[model samples]
Target: MKSLLSLLLASLLSVFSLPGLAQTPEAQSLLASVLALKPNAERGEAEFVAQACSACHRKDGSGKSAGNTPRLSGQHGAVIIKQVLDIRSGLRHNPPMQPRVTEQSLSLQTLADIAAHLQALPISGTIAKGPGSGVARGKELFAKDCAGCHGANGQGNQATFVPMVAAQHYGYSLRELEFIRDGKRGNSNRAMASLIKTYDQDDLLALADYMAQLPAPQRK
Candidate 1:
């Protein structure tokens, strides 16, 4: 009986852990690029606020406490650069950023500079989604703050800077929201920054759950 139980547990653990352990080379490379980023605070921060990133993100980098916009402050530099590249090159899937890009409101160089800056800020906290009340509140907040950009189902705009928030890690998402709110992660779209500004802690956590539940983005 004991041998059978041990075997069962081992199998389960392997099934669960294989993906993380067997990350594709591409995945490892991409993650490595993101992790290697280092922020040039003085230059980057100045660039961040000057680029009008502060308008919607607020002066602190915390957004409106709601919306589909991502937080950038204190984020990995690699992630910021990757996202900026996506937005500038029209690789971002989120639909909303296309219009702004068309207007040349955010230039590719500006995106890079801002991305470098945002990666320097500190990470923020997320609101927890408890068993009962937290879930309900999270839903309400998601509807009010995140639906338009994130979609009701958290199917984010993939073409633009908007990411597919669903199925993301909660801690990552939580910190991401904080960066957006603080102007560390956003600014390319003033409208998005405005939307993100509405979120608070609890609202952020709820958003994380909603995002985590979403389907992962399809490979191109």
Candidate 2:
């Protein structure tokens, strides 16, 4: 009984502690600088290759579904910038991405350019999807809980720095959603964390599947 109580207390502490871990001042400043610069997609294309980002994310930023990489094509530049900055600042934990995105590795201009290039890439190819059984429940949950922030079609808002979830890889989405729900993702939005805190594994599965099946937003 004592061990059980201790474990429960530790769990609560972990959850509460995560809220303070994200968005360092340095990260925010860097994000602002990156966002202010005019991105050169042409330069970005070259940089992306030079940086070996294509090795995992692919040349087109479609990401590797089997590798559990989130699709970056057509995602908002602001969203991408913020995530990169967060990872660099250690506000977000991505072991594989950490060394590659260090300050010495990516200049503000290069980061901006990379973001632009990825955002402009068209989402294509076969995205990994979940089992069809949960899609209906997922759709219903998204409409009720996620549509307001992520848009009805899951086309995330650029100005708000929300990511486009339409057609994202199912495995990646589910993994991230689970991380967010469990307070394991340090950079998670507070409101989003709160909203999903009570969600179970089944709920997360449905949500990921529904988002995965949504059509990719048409880029202008």
Candidate 3:
């Protein structure tokens, strides 16, 4: 009975301790910098472009239109690194992204190396726009559902883990909404999940269209 009880206690302790094992952006960054194990920019660049990351996000970090993937240009390196880790940890849901991030290895060094390379890319100036019957409907949905944390303008609060959406590539923005709806993105973002849960397919599309017309976010 004592042995069985001890085993049960150990199982409970492991379950409770998993969160502490999650990699932090700071941890990944420090390790990459200190160990000099970050993949060279050249290697990372090749890997990024050659790998499927470029397909949805664009080669110049401009972003795609069909996939609703976002512009990856000029994102904070730490934030970028953490996102990949979050997806793997199921803190964010992304079955598609999970495979890629964990494909080679889900180590912190690999995440940091990819982030470093992406951060160095030149920004694309292609702003998004939308015009259609659904624009007004999309705007209404944004006002009612999305504007609180993402701002009325879709400029997100990074501190809140709310990503900027104003002038984000329509494809990328739509993708984000889809992920939220499917419970594949923003696992840690209660507000986002709640907002998305109330959204239908048309609502998601409209939100994407409306956000496409907003002004670009100011980078730090």
Best by TM-score: 2
Q: Would you list the rank order by lDDT, best first?
A: 2, 3, 1
Clashing pairs in 2: none
Model 1 misplacement above 4 A: 1-39, 99-109, 124-207, 210-220
Local accuracy of candidate 2 as per-residue lDDT tens digits, 164-200? 9999999999999988888787888788888898778
Q: State residue 33's C-alpha deviation in candidate 2, in Å.
A: 0.9
CA lDDT, candidate 1, residue 3: 49
Q: After superposition, how far is residue 202 of candidate 2 from its true place, in Å?
A: 0.7
How would you encode candidate 3's per-residue C-alpha lDDT over 5-105 as one tens digit per residue? 24433433342234533345554444334233444666666767666688877777777655546677755454475567567656676777778777365
The superposed Cα distance between candidate 3 and the true structure at residue 1, in angstroms, equals 57
Give the CA lDDT, 0 to 100, for residue 104 in model 3: 68
Report the lDDT tens digits of candidate 1 across residue range 130-185.
22435566677778767876677665542222444544445557666776677665
Q: What is the lDDT, from 0 to 100, of the residue 209 in candidate 3? A: 83
